[model samples]
Target: MHIRKDLSPGKQSLLTTGSFLIPLFLWTIVSYAPFIWHPDIKLQVSADRSGVTTVFTAGDRVSKEFFPTFSEAIRVENQAIMEAREQNKPIIGSRRDNLKKLRHLAPLAVANGWLEVKEQQNDEKLYGVWKGLAEGSLKSTEVELTEENIEVIRSNWRLLSAYAPTYDSKRYPTEAMLKLIPQGVSSNPVYLPAPHEVIQAGWRDFTTKPDNDMPTMWERYRHSLTIIFWGFTYSCLLGIPLAILCGSLDFFSKLHEPFIDFFRYMPAPTFSVLFVAFLGTSDAPKIMLVFVGTFFQLVLVIANTTRLLEKSLLEAAQTLGANRRQLLKRVIVPGILPNLYNDLRILLGWSWTWLVIAELIGEKTGLTGFIDTQGTRYNFDRVFPVIILIGFTGFFTDRFFHGLRDLLFPWTEEAQTGAKGPITRFILRMSNHSSYADRTKA
Candidate 1:
């Protein structure tokens, strides 16, 4: 007899560590590399200022402006240098020309000035610039050089000239500079939402409040789940029995085949619309939508399973002296059990997909309705989480039925036993030792 050698503890630990690290390394490379390399802009402040000046980033006190269009500002600065050099003397020129040129080149300076003056004065005159820009009153052609504008322009130029070397170097200020800047005078740094904000935004309020009596989030989830569950269940119940009857009886088979074929081609949504016309936008229409969507597929599955079972095993049972009822109970059902289970799984998945459409038009409460509401309100955060939840829930439910098939029909040679049978039994056994032992003994 040969004894199988298990992996040693140290080797196992090393293997597990490697396994975990490999994926982590891959995920880090795949998911985080881009974000690390190039961070996205969460907030943008485009100041219509005079010259290239200090800009504020989140958590940073004063960083140099990095606008692509700031080349015009540099050109103006170069022109100013050339003009001053051409004079060959400290020529005290009118500040208005430089100010106007600066304002044109870097409107961001104007915006920055406006922001600054707005902080000091509670007057409407201070807000006139921003309000004009926002309301589209200040066009590119109209350079309204007011007293307020000149003061803002002069102040911004001074600030930008002081910070010019830092801008050229692409270097941020020290902590000392950040601390020295007064509140509301320093640039306003916009903060993006933290992880907690993102999480909180994902939750939706669906329940009835004092102001409004609408369904809750839990209610919508429960309603959708119920619709999917019952729709598949009732479809299977009705379709499978009828299919079995039709397949077993030749006369019934001839009568039902054409009708089934007709309905299979007829679209469910069309029928749902008709049902809504008849039943109104009540629960009946919603339930009927799910039913119609699932029914045809269920019929096709059940009919095929019945036909196959009958052709293969029904004749065998009959040759072995089995009656009609006996054949159905023993041979027919047993032969078709795996196929039926497969059909059920397919229908369940289909039902989940269709339930969305069912709730979209007719139902008051469901995932589809919730998604629609969120979409109308522009709540993308809530929509994505619900969609993710639906996908994961469907995956787990399909896997569950696959596990169920293996557990109940293990005698079949081709039955799948993927991590579900022995593993599940082992876990259950650990939980209920006496019951497990009795089951094993039996």
Candidate 2:
């Protein structure tokens, strides 16, 4: 007697290793390609005694306008030195430069009440105030002035101040720099609708007007379930019977195969448009689109499975003196059951893709409809979340059907190991215990 093994240890090891390496390879390719191929653009900086401009490779840096220019930057540096002079603190420029003047004057300014420090606008404001005070026009008492008033004075002071002679005065601004100032200074930050605002606006438009309001996330989820339920119900009703007829009879197989194949390739969007025209823009069109989307695929699947059953199993049943009804009940139906379950799982996945087109036809609801509305409004952030939801839901649903398959066909080793839920474990244990008791008695 020979013992049969479906999977050998070596084959199993190979499969396990392949699975691990494939993912690692894919991740490496996806993670590294973008970085290596496309590096971030570098900025070009040009400076003259007048001012300095920074040109970025991409779109303008709008934040630069509020930030000081290079000339203003230098003035800020000079102001720091002058402040040290007022404070009689040692000035530190290059290591070689003497700080004796700043050190000598430091305490005198403090004693005279000329040097003042306060928790002002920021480092920039503090520096501006120090510059003003060092120049002798701004009083140390005015350091407590509001930022708005300080800014007014700072702008006036910048305009009146002469360029420092220490820095070079000649350099032509490049096209990049010429472009950078306007682009940087003029560009405004992109604004997004807040969640509260989005919800309020969506409701205002959706509730009062036609085709304006998009469905909420919950609404889309509910609609998805509804479409899946109805689509499955319709496909099972129409597909299984047609499959039986086509499988059992040669005449029907010849007649139906061509027609089913034709519909299988017909685009869902085209069908959606036609359904909308025929049925008008209502739930009927949406349901019909889902039906058409699922039906042809289910038919092809069931028909193929049924044919295999008839050829291999039905002949044996007929020889055993079984009538058509008995043969169907005992052999044909059970033989097709596993394949039918598998087909339904595939159809469920296809239904989601179809639902997108279905929802596009004046749906005003469901995930696809929500995506459409987001795209129209240019709300890419909102659009991305919906896409992620759809992917996760589809994955979970596929896992569910696979779980169902395992529960129904527990004789297969794949089924037993695939069962993940506690309830499935309980059922398997009870099933095993009963089988063991019968074996012991025998």
Candidate 3:
């Protein structure tokens, strides 16, 4: 199809900007929208009732009596302040201090419906919300009260809980008493988050002083790239020649098909244990995993792509008095060049999918490895950036190959549609110069 080339500069710019910005806008909406869906943040305590914790995840059921009384909140705040002062520090902490300011802001939180409470308490009320938080029925993380929030709480306590009741903690069966705080309450549609959280978490981790010998994000990315580069290189070395032979010779094709097909269907992950056992805990197993994952499929694709060469071109070459060897080299290989390049480009992307799987088998030091470790700790903020990095790396790599292909095969129909970029022009000039020199030598 003839694509329109008459777009104005403004329209072109708009298209270019939209192509990038639209996805980012959509992604942001998806990531932040969950806060709207599950707006209620709740104060939880550890399963053992040692201390208070907070959960940001939405969907916790709040009971009518879930909110702590003004006295209980004050007691918690006093404990925090005492602890901070004992440590020769201010009453503030650096993490999860939203509730620390609660003493001062409790009244505001209650007035704004950020905090909810039931007016009457009864023995049979069965504090479902309180039990859930205390017994670990709900997923919970212990958060520290920030110094700023502590000051906010102490100063604002009177205004915060003006109407809060006095209650006895021992009277309730719940080991932990939890107060519900609304982050946002909406039934509206939204998107989930992992990437944004990952980037944020990763940045935090990067900035924080490391407690151990964990590799940085750049180091992990470098390791992943190293594995993929070598694995893909090895796969091409073994696969391409085999694929060419299979495509050119019927005996080879028939003989290899059964074994190739069987191995391809066997699945790469199944070999994870085997590879580790055989290759040990080094990078060899991971590289081999990538190779196994890409090699057979790549061979099959290339062979099929080679077979799709037009019969007319082969016949024409033969008609021009070309022998079998020359026809195979000068005709079949050349005929399949553009298609083979595209096939390899696509397979290169497929190779990346195996990276995480490969890295999982032996060493856990790459981007995927870090993601796997942090994911268990619910640190998706760290995980998200690595995933995005993988995408960006793949996108730019694909573009690089595409541009390189255009430069190498300017005569192909794919190359003719767009204006040649500087790289293509430069290569074309070099090519012309080399051809001119060859002619002069002859």
Find the candidate with the highest lDDT and give its number. 3
Deviation in Å, model 2, residue 383 alpha carbon: 2.1
Give candidate 3's whole-model lDDT.
0.63
lDDT of 3 by residue, 207-281 (tens): 665558877667778999999999999999999888987887888899996799788999998998999999999
Error of 3 at 363 (Å): 2.4
TM-score of each: 0.57, 0.54, 0.64
The clash number for model 2 is: 9
| lDDT on C-alpha atoms for all candidate structures | 0.57, 0.56, 0.63
lDDT by residue for model 2 over 241-284, one digit each (tens)?
A: 88877877778888998888987887766866778788987777
Which residue runs of candidate 2 sit more than 4 Å off their true CA positions? 1-214, 310-312, 412-442
Q: Considering TM-score, which of the candidate structures 1 and 2 is the better prediction for this target?
A: 1
